[model samples]
Target: MEIKNNRLTGATFVEANAYNKTAVMKPDAIIIHYTAGASGNATVKLFAAKTSKTSAHFVVSEDGTITQMVDLNRKAYHAGTSSYNGRSSYNNFSIGIEISNPGYLQKIDGKYYTWWEVKKDKKTATPEDKVYVGKHRNAVTTMTYWYKYTDEQIKAVKELCQAICKAYDIKEILGHEEIAPGRKCDPGPAFPLDALRADIVSNTKKDLNVSELFKDAVKESASTSLTIGRVKVKLNFRQSPSSNAPLKSSPMAADTYVYIIGSDSTGEWYNILYEMTGWMDKEFVEQDNTDDNYDGELTTNSAMLYNDQKKSRRLVSDLKAGTKFNILDQQENMFRIQAVVEGWASSKYITKI
Candidate 1:
C-alpha cells in the first residue's frame, strides 16, 4: 500500500461531515480507536451524518476492508480533550484510525454481549474466541471483556500504519486509551497496541536513517550554526518550541547524539536533528562547544598519540592504522583522543567518522 497526496491509494474514500476544514494539520502521530459499533460501514455512515459531530480518518472492517472518511492532512475529531507527554488536544497533530469492534463487552450469564447489541433487544452473545477477558489499563480493579480484533483487521491496520509512516514523518503510534486514559479506553487491551507500535516505528526509523535525515534538513534550512549535543537525560522531542507541544515520539534516551541547528526565541529550547527533527530542552542537552565533534580514525601505519598539543609534545603511544577513537577536544592542528591512552593526535593523520 502507498499514500499519495495525503491519501491511501487503494483504500475507499468517503467524506465525513465532522472535521477541521480550515485549520492546517501536519500529523506526526496515529491514534487507534474502536468503533464501539457494529461494523466499518456503520461507523462510516455515522461519520457521514450531518449531526455526527465526531469523525475519524479511517475505519477498518473485520474482513480487512478499509474506508477513509477524512483526508490524512485534515484534523479528524477523534481524540477529545486529550493529552500525552504534557501536550493537549491530540486532534491537532494526529491521524485517527477507528477499528470496527464492539469495544468493552458485558458478560451476562457467562455470555459476552456488546452494550450496543444488548440495547437493541437482540441480546446475541459474542463467540468465546472473539471475546478477550482482561483489565483495561485505566481500570483500578475492574476486569473487562473486550471484543478481540480479527487477524485480518490487525494486518490491515499494520499495513495502513506502515503506509502512513512512509508517507509522512509519523513519530508515534498511540492508543486512544493512552491519550485519554480516564475518559476513554479504545483499541483496548484486546488489541496488540504496543507490539504494533514497536514493529511499525522500528521499521520507519530504519527506512530513514538519522544522519541522512540531518543532511537533508541542513541542506534545505537557512544558514545557521550547526553544533553537536548529547542528551544528558531522557528528553522529550517536541514538535514546537514549547513544553506544551506534541511529542515527536518516545523520550530520547540519555546520551543520544543530536545536531543543534537553532534555538527558539527564549533560547531555552534547541531545535535538533537526530532520529527525527524536533525541539529539545537546552538544559538537558550537553552542547559540544568545539566546532568539530566526531569519531576519528588513524590513517597512517604508525600515528603518534601525544599527551599535549605543543611544539615538543610528550609521546603517549604509537597507534596503529585504522585505530578508532572519539575526538574529545581540539587545538590548532591537533585533536585530543579518548583511546587506550588518552592523548592528542595530529589532525592530518585522522579522518572523521
Candidate 2:
C-alpha cells in the first residue's frame, strides 16, 4: 500500500535471520500486551535475543516511552495462537504494542525480590510433610505487588495509537486478551480499553476531512464580530491548525480585524485558521453580536415624549453626553426625542428641540 503517513518513528526492528525473510503484512488491527518484564529495556533485550523467539512491534516503558522492536509493515513475533472476530493468524495482520509490567502473578520472599515483589512458598519435604508432600500446601509469604501504570505511559500509548491509526487504515484496535481470549491476557483489565477505544473513534472521526470543516467555519464566521475588549486582537497564524506546527507571524493588531478561515480538532489541539486565514485562540474570539449596541438600547427619532399609543423606548446614547435628548414619546421601534447640545450650539443639528 501507499505510505499516506509515517507515524512509526522511534521503533527498532529485528529481521528473522534464520528465516532469511521479514514478515511484511498490512496490519488490520492493533494488539496491546504487557511485557511481563520489569523494564522496557529488558523487554527490548528479550525480543533482540535470537533464542527468545518472541517480539512485539513496540514496547512501552512504565513511564510511557516507546521502543519499537519491529516495523509496522513487517509482522512482529507477538500474538501467538491469537484470533480476533473469528479470524486467525493475528500476528500477520496486527500491530503489537507491549507495555512493560510484571507478569500476572509473582511470588514474594523469592530470590528476585524488589519493592514490588511477589511471594512464592518454598516446599520442604519431611516425614510428617511427606504424607502431604504429594499434595503439598506450602505457606507462601505475601508481598504487595502493585499494578500501576504511570500517566506518562498512558499518554505515550494514546499518542502512538493515534499516529498509527492516521498512518494505516486501521479500524480495529484491541488488547491481546480480547483477540486471543483463553490463550493470552497481557493487557489485562487494568488497561482502560473502553476509554481508549472511545478516544480513538472520536479522533478518527475528527481527522476525516477536517480541512473542509475548517473552511466552512471560516465562511460562516465572516459576519461575526471577533473582539477583545472592543478592539480586535491579532491572530497567531500557523501553517496548520495543529500546535505542533511552527508559529506564524501575527497578521493583525488589536485594532485590526479579520474573518475566521477554517478549523480542525486533533485530540486536544483545535486547529483553526488557514493560509487564507490565521490561527486564533478559541478563548479570544467572541461570536458575532448582531445587535447594534452592547448596552441593548434603542436609537431615537425627532420627538422625545412618551407616545401613550406606543410602548417604551430606551435612550440609546447617554443623556449626560454632549448630545442630550428629551423624551417626548415612546414607541416600539421608533423613539421620539428633542435634543439640545451641551452649550448653546446650533439648532441645525437638533430636531424638535
**Colliding residue pairs in candidate 1:** none
Candidate 2: segments with Cα more than 4 A from true spot: 1-7, 10-20, 103-146, 208-353
Q: How well is each residue in 222-308 modelled by candidate 2, as lDDT tens digits?
A: 454222121246645556655566666655455433344334564332233332444556545543323211111222322222212
* Candidate 1 C-alpha lDDT tens digits along 1-353: 88899899988999999999998899888899999999888899999999989999999999999999899889999998766543468999999999999887766667878877757774589999888977655443345678999999999999898888777777567888766653466887899886786576456466732134523433433365356788899999999999999999999999777778788999999988874679999999987533222367778775776658998665544565555556888999998885433568889998888
The TM-score of predicted model 1 comes to 0.60
Question: Which window of ten consecutive residues has the lowest lDDT sum in model 2?
Answer: 130-139
| lDDT for each candidate structure | 0.78, 0.50
TM-score of 2: 0.46
